[model samples]
Target: MATTNFDCIVVGSGNAGSCAALAAKDSGCSRVLILDKCPPDWVGGNGYFTAGAHRTVHGGLADLLPIVRNVSPGSDLASTIDMDPYTAEDFTGDIMRLGGGRSDPGLVKTLVENSRDAVQWLHDRVRTPFTFSFNRQAYLVDGRQKFWGGMVLSTDNGGKGVIDAHQKALNEAGVEIWFDTPAIEFILEEEAIVGVVARRDGQAVRLAAPAVVLASGGYESSREMRGKYLGPGWERAKVRGTPYNTGDGLALARSVGAKLTGDFAGCHSTCWDFDAAADTGDRLLSNQYTKSGYPLGLMVNSNGLRFVDEGEDFRNYTYAKFGREIMNQPGGCAWQVWDSKTTSWLRDEEYGDGVVRKVWANTLEELAETLAEDGLQDKAQFLDTIHTYNLAVDAFVQQHPTTKWDPAVKDDLSTHSLPLPKSNWALPITSPPFLAVKVTCGITFTFGGLAIDPDTAGVLSEETGKPITGLFCTGELVGGLFYGNYPGGSGLTAGAVFGIKAGREAAKLARRL
Candidate 1:
């Protein structure tokens, strides 16, 4: 404990914590320290497992070309692309709408307003490897690269690349990060946080800091917490990120009388590979375990029924909540079936050569039989569901011959006369060589967390209904931005936004102290 003091101490060394630490240093904090409960391998925490999809408001392709390394303006490739400008209204509306109007307006506004700036800051200041998410966002349709869904940016090499950039930036900033050190509690003096008590090398060490930022992720990793808060059967959902994000910071903050907010029973979940690890995410595979191709086809549960409107919206908007619907099925799992015409469109990262065990057959009957072996309990009903779905598509196309099937946008190529009609991009399953992939729910992060002041990112007090002096929070730890559902890519954007705010404010508080 030679220098047992710092201007600011950040708990958790994930994307949010790293962002806060960098912002603190850049904002004039001389000594900033980061503490993580995980070992060195989990350096970036859940950020290490992210797909690095960064959703931000931008002026379409022209605005993004400067920060991205994938494509350049005036190129032949650029001429073949179609990208629509995304405004703050689009971003704000998406979060509030998807979250069922439960997201805090102040927090959502703060997040949406600063989103583009945060992306630019990440590129310019952190030297993050930015690239157009062509593989995930855009698709080639008739020699045109059309971008859909409002998300267009991702780090090269996904989460690994994002974390690598943070590591380099942290090293340059000289921020000392202590791995395998878990913050057990905060030192509160006269009802204001003054320091942190953490277990370092199996010893209790007290580190002095006028401001402490809690960015230690959420309770998604703890099966107990999941079962307790997120309702029944969530404990069985596959963990899509770091195992260390077990609500440690939430507990630490609550121990000091922090107010909890957001929908405790809700979370960001998705269709994960059925065969994926149940307890933790695979570092090597990372977000590849996600099976989001359901938006391109149809999904049937164990009873062999189409449970959701696959084309309810862009995959980005609907994927998070669909996982919970899958869990609600009879067996708590489902199968995504696509035909030869659309199977090729599935991203290589998710359904390519060896991403997961895939079932293939030249006929629908054989496909159903194959899936039955893997968990399709009602093969006869599965065949009937496909038959009825194909009939509806044929009827719709016959009535509206002008409509074209385009995956890049919601072209309204829908099904007709069905109890649960697919809204758009609906095509007949007539192509041979069908494919089916089994999937289960993958929990990303718990939405429940500490209530924070939207302006300064300070943790709010439960008793006083005010900001706790010298105590701040960011990332998944500081919630109230999401509820029943979440907008894809907003997680990282929200984290960076509040992380920067927390850092700057905490640095000011630290200097004053």
Candidate 2:
């Protein structure tokens, strides 16, 4: 029985919801409210569990120098950094190539063209502390910071900093955020959404708003939904983000006859720590549970055989889709093998001390014996795999004697004469103190949800294939942008881009009321 009327209401408190709320407030909505289903502890949604990497277009390092707060162009350290400019064509090619050309061309164009401007908005309006990702995206190759994979900028403290910056902006603009409120259904009048009915403080509350934006994330947290949509054995995959994104937005939109789109059977999954919590992501460790070092080494399943070409591309290009490969392997798990040569180069945040459970031995045979206790099936096979792989590397080096191993580029330091080839960064894992870590599939978000108008972010109707009058959507709830695979760091950018469109249109609708 409290005051429930609002000019506009945004659901979910994740990156997209926060952006929508801020944009709505800035677009002339006097009273904007954000409804979050989870408690205050889960404020930032999946953004809190992310590494805060934002991929965008730029004129190389010179274009990015004005936005980043970490390094100064006049400093000596800046002289050693090598960053290439990423054009709109480059961003679009990554998406279309990874998605197998199934991505909506209209949505892809909108996202690619506006990505840099959206990131700039975050830096200027939202006060996001952008910094060059020296620790994650760059490698200290030849004593110079060489950035690869066309991704350079990330938040200063990763996802925590991103959410903190959004929170600060929202608070400054007087946006009302109601936690522990789960939106149950849209209040439809003659098939047009006029408001939403949510559970607030253990009671059903109707919040009257002319425009309602559903940015409440995906159904990755729902094991039932995952099993139903993503096929069998998907329920066993570990969740890498919040547990509250359980298809509430999809269900609400479905009730209003909204069209569902995108790849229901696919999701953004990665090689996570084998010992990580299965139910939800750890707030403290966050994305540190990621095990992406396989590119610099080799991966063998429990059956003691390599399954994927670990160096098929840069980690950013392959990491999101490789988790499904692990799930298909024996026992739905695998172990990455590295020797003393490349173990020192692994990112300290993911493979560092106290971050993951590591198995080490002085010899490959000893490593196999130790890993056998931890689910490895065959010791002889593991050793044979290593021996054969090392021989292939030697053969490749013999053929190309001048080949230099460089992680910053596709140096073609690859292995030949193998059934499945390691295309690049293939070094012999024959050094002392061999290291291995267990890895499993950890899903970040689902790729299926409501279809929306690309220009206004308005949810489309299922029957007539038109925009639903007062309903808008953003974030993971807006489908058609992705299919089987996604480029790294583009998720956050897409959310911000659509969030701006949804907020401006929702604010216009609220004004009409």
The whole-model lDDT of each prediction reads 0.90, 0.92
lDDT of 1: 0.90
Candidate 2 residues 1-513, lDDT tens each? 454789889998989989999999999999999999999999989998999999998999889998999999888888999999999999999999999999999899999998999999999999999999988789998889999999998998899999999999999999999999998878888877888888987899888888999999999999999999998988889999998889999988998899999998899999989899888999999999999999989999998999999999999999999999998888889999899999998998999999999998998888988999999999898999989999999999999999999999998888857989999999998889999999999999989889998888999999999999989999988898988889899999999999999999989988887
Q: Please name the candidate that would achieve the greatest lDDT relative to the true structure.
A: 2
Model 1: per-residue lDDT, tens digit, 1-513?
543889999998878888999999999899999998889998988888888999999998889999988788899998998999999999999998998898999999999999999999999999989988889889999999998989989989998998999999999999999999999978889999999889999999989998999999999999899989988888789999898889988889889999999989988899999999988899999999999998789999998899999999999899889889998998789999999889889999999878988888999999888877777899999999999999999999899999998898998999858999999989888898888899999988888899999999999999998999999999998778998888788888888999999999989987785
List candidate 1 stretches off by more than 4 Å. 1-3
